[model samples]
Target: MIRTATPDDVPLIHAMVRDLAEYEKALDEARATEEQLREALFGERPAAFGHIAQDDDSGEVVGFALWFLNFSTWRGVHGIYLEDLYVRPEARGGGHGKALLRELARICVERGYERLEWSVLDWNEPSINFYKSLGALPQDEWTVYRLTDGALAGLGAAVE
Candidate 1:
């Protein structure tokens, strides 16, 4: 069973986020709090959306996917930028990942979104192959860039 997440799902979602961080070798940077997750997903203006997959028999959540909308100037249509997709190791290989991705695509088609995009770590060959099997291509022409902490804080000052 897959469905949109609600405020009550925060703790489970946070745990999944931490698990994904650990898997990606960034456990030290996984400092998200319950409050942050609640506000980001359930506030008056949601910053992102989340969906959970549960075990039908046990009624326990086994995986989740989180994403935000992004504008694509080239495509002239909004796209879903998947931020996280996770399934507990025990729950993997049961088609949960593909199911979650297919759900995202369904949402996109419903909303008339032109694209869906996400990034997987270079070392995660299984994920890369899975995505490729689904016909998702890597945007090799464009490189991603980021600035955190002090650099991000200085953006306003630098502009002025």
Candidate 2:
């Protein structure tokens, strides 16, 4: 079963995020704290939303997806930018990942969103193949860029 996450699920969400980072070989980079997640997910103006996938029989949350809305100026529509989607190692091959994605797709269709998108590490062939199997196309022509940490701080200081 899959359902929208609530504030009470912040701890689980944080743990799952760490698990995902570990799987991606970047555990040290998972620096988000539970308080940050709570504020971001359930603050006065939420910055993102989350979904949890549970095992019906065991009633345990085995996976989760965290996403936020983004505007596509060219398309003149909104889209969902999935930041993380993960299923526990023991829960693989159980359709949980696909179910979470399908739920996101359904939300897009219901809300008239233009697209649902996320980035995957190039080395993760298994996830790439899974996404392809769902008919998701890769935007290979576009390059992703980042401006964070010191660079981000530098830009803010320059403006000041």
Candidate 3:
């Protein structure tokens, strides 16, 4: 079963996020606290939204997808930016990830989103193949950039 996540699912989401981080060999950077997730997802003003998939018989959460909306100037329509998709190791071949992605696609269609996008690590060949099979092509023309720590702080100072 796939459904919208609630505040009560924060712990489960946190655990799964850490699991995903570990799987990707980035556990050291995964530090999402329950309070942070709750406030970001369930506060008066939600910063993002998420959906969780559970095993119907066992009632255990097997996967989740988190996303946010973005505006595409070129397309002149909104798009969904999938931030995370994680399925338990034991549940990989069970179609949970596909189901979650399809669900998000449906939401995108219903909302008239211009596109759905997510990034996959270059080394994750399995995921790259899966996405290719789903007709998703990587946008190699654009490069992603980030500002962190002192760089992020320096941005404000530069404007002044």
The whole-model lDDT of each prediction reads 0.93, 0.95, 0.90
Worst 10 residues of 3 by lDDT: 151-160
lDDT of candidate 2 over 1-160, digit per residue (tens): 9999999999999999999999999998889999999999999999999999999899999999999999999999999999999999999889999999999999999999989999999999999999999999999999999988999889888953
Instruction: In candidate 3, list every pair of residues with a backbone clash.
Output: none
Candidate 2, clashing residue pairs?
none
* Per-residue lDDT of model 3, residues 1-160, tens digit only: 8999998898999999899899899999888898998898999899889999998789899999988898899999999999999999888878888889999999989989979999998899988998898899999898888897799888967963
TM-score of 2: 0.96
- Candidate 2: where are CA atoms >4 Å away? none
- Candidate 1 on 1-160: residue-level lDDT in tens? 8899999999999999999999999999999898999999999899999999897788889999999999999989999999999999999887888889999999999999989899889899989998999999998887889888898889956953
> Residue 110 deviation, candidate 3, in Å?
0.7
The residue ranges of model 3 lying beyond 4 angstroms of the native Cα positions read none
Clash counts for all predictions: 0, 0, 0
Specify the highest-TM-score model's number.
Answer: 2
TM-scores for candidates 1 onward, in order: 0.95, 0.96, 0.94
